[model samples]
Target: MKKLMLALAVASLSSAAIAQETYTVTDVPVKEKSVETNSFWSNWFISAGVNYNAFYSSQEEGISKNPFNDRGKFGFNVAVGKWFTPGLGIRAKFDGVKGVQVNGGVWSPDNIDFDYWNLHSDVLFNLSNMIFGYNENRVWNFIPYLGAGVIRNCSQNNYMMGANVGILNTFRLNKRLSVNFELSALAAPKSFDGIGYKASGNKIWRGADKVFTASVGLTVNLGKTTGFRKAVDVDALMALNASQLDALNSALAAQQNENARLKEELAKKPKEVIKTDYRKEYVGAPRSIFFNIGSSQIASRKEIVNLQVLADAVKADSNIKLKVTGYADSATGSAAFNQKLSEKRANRVADELVKLGVSRDNLVVEGLGGVATLKPNSYNRRVIVDVVK
Candidate 1:
């Protein structure tokens, strides 16, 4: 019994599982107009470039050489950048510039070779993608940036805080790599060049020092052909999950209901067991209909009337069933002939019950051969009909 119950439980669960379908979560591409819907770790880029820097500072007559005669210096910059949106990003950069001339006044007429290192944190904007939307195959993009950070003159052992602004032009080579051209200007305090000039017997300060820089570099994207990715909408995914759940529940309910009906049908079916004699108790009084010896037909109209009355009673209550037993006189013909006659009598009575509106299924017909007897042989050759409620 425990095993049966366990099997039933497992079957029920299996039905429920079959009713509820399973789904796998997949990456769905959704297009939106405004926001970047990409992976958080995507769109990172690093770049390395060589730069030419030109410096400008306050000069004095008769003491300052022409700085522009051999002005520009060689430098290199490296930057790591990330785009927060399709059009906006930030970069942290380092630059090392050498071979710059910091000229002195009358005290030191010669020029001193100077080198500087700069660190910058800059905000970047992609003008091309902003104006035309993003296109991977587009050959060129124009980006501009503004930054402020520290600059250290390694040769002079001095540090100064400054700001720079630049415009970058990029040409795409493939999805992951690009070539970049940049033009920028840097400005710092007057003492940034580490030179103080004396005029009229007093040391004087000048305007800010400025450097114009131009560079070319290779930019490499960190991951994927499409530099950026879009973010998935949480609400949309939640709604889909809820809808799928509702459908699963409805199917499960239907499966459960079907399983219950099958269980009921199975319970009602007859099982294989040992056959036993079941004594039937009758409802109301037992009635007898007499028949002539050797004749299976109903010869008397009185017998027919009695059969009709019994049929009506059984029909009135569907729960009532009738047992019809036919008997023959023991002193009559051979036992085999008497048994056949008895069966015919029983069947004739059952037919009458059916014609009188009683269901045939409600009448159980049987033949008892010439074995049992009553005092009157004529009465012995008769069919006995009794109601089993």
Candidate 2:
């Protein structure tokens, strides 16, 4: 019955570790670069491993006994674990020992036999960065964890509960798989059942048992998190935006002025009107289009295709510039939802334009939610393309 309960607990833990919630790709771009100093909450993982244990017994008189005549007795353990964050996690383990041998008798010397099983629950702390230099690139690949747990050991005639400490190392193969190795020390409570030996004229039994264990196995992650990349510091990114754009524009203007001056100097020296049939007449206008989607920015295929056509037209016209205005139909939903939906539509159009070879700097994008659009009109669902030359 105890063994059955232990097995159920381990199975439940394993299931929970494997079960994960998935996010949509449209919601978050998967290719976004991760920031170096992001919090650990974003990277969570789960694992399982096969383990081997060494059991050592002791007498009530404070005399410890080595179960092996000349070697330590061996056992087995299996565990399921999950990391709530990058460096912290919890694990549940099922452990058992068989063929345990102990010293017995002084008159007719022979070894006594004992066997037991244990169920444990523990919380793990990561220490890979402390021991080894683990920065962003390497941190995801190699990690070391230390943990402490309560152990419940059950035998044929005895049941003991105690505590244990352990250490483990994991090598991540990818986002969905990893290799794990673990080592632990289990301290079992005192037992008074006598072995087949007499000590100080009293029947001798093993006292507290200390067990050392090691394991290695592979872990499989079930549902994957969409954007596994590092987080971007929004504050830092926003702060850098204006300065970067200004520097870029300044450099571009300087180059354009230099080119114009050189062209004039060359024309003064000697010039010819090199007319070619390949030259195409430019007569395009710059346009800004606005669209109002409802509380959700999940555009249908038809809508996306319409936007694509609009983008292509702008791209074919070198003289035309585009400005996209995104709005929410009403203030019926939560303000936050409306704001996000508006932004989503704006970003979606901007992305499509970029794909159609429109320079992002030349395209202006803005979101005006709820406060502007009073009702849901099919015309309001429309994208207004204002062409400006």
Highest lDDT against the true fold, candidate? 1
lDDT of 2 by residue, 213-308 (tens): 777877655443411334555666665665556765775566556555545654564433323221121112222234534623434545554455
Clashing pairs in 2: 34-230, 58-207, 286-321, 286-387, 286-388, 287-386, 287-387, 287-388, 288-386, 289-384
Q: Measured by TM-score, how close is model 1 to the native structure?
A: 0.47
- Which window of ten consecutive residues has the lowest lDDT sum in model 1? 274-283
Q: Summarize candidate 1's per-residue lDDT along 259-323 as a digit string, tens digits.
A: 67656554565352312211121124466777887898887877777666567677777887999
TM-scores of the candidates are 0.47, 0.48
Show where candidate 1 strays beyond 4 Å.
1-32, 60-68, 102-109, 196-206, 224-226, 230-389
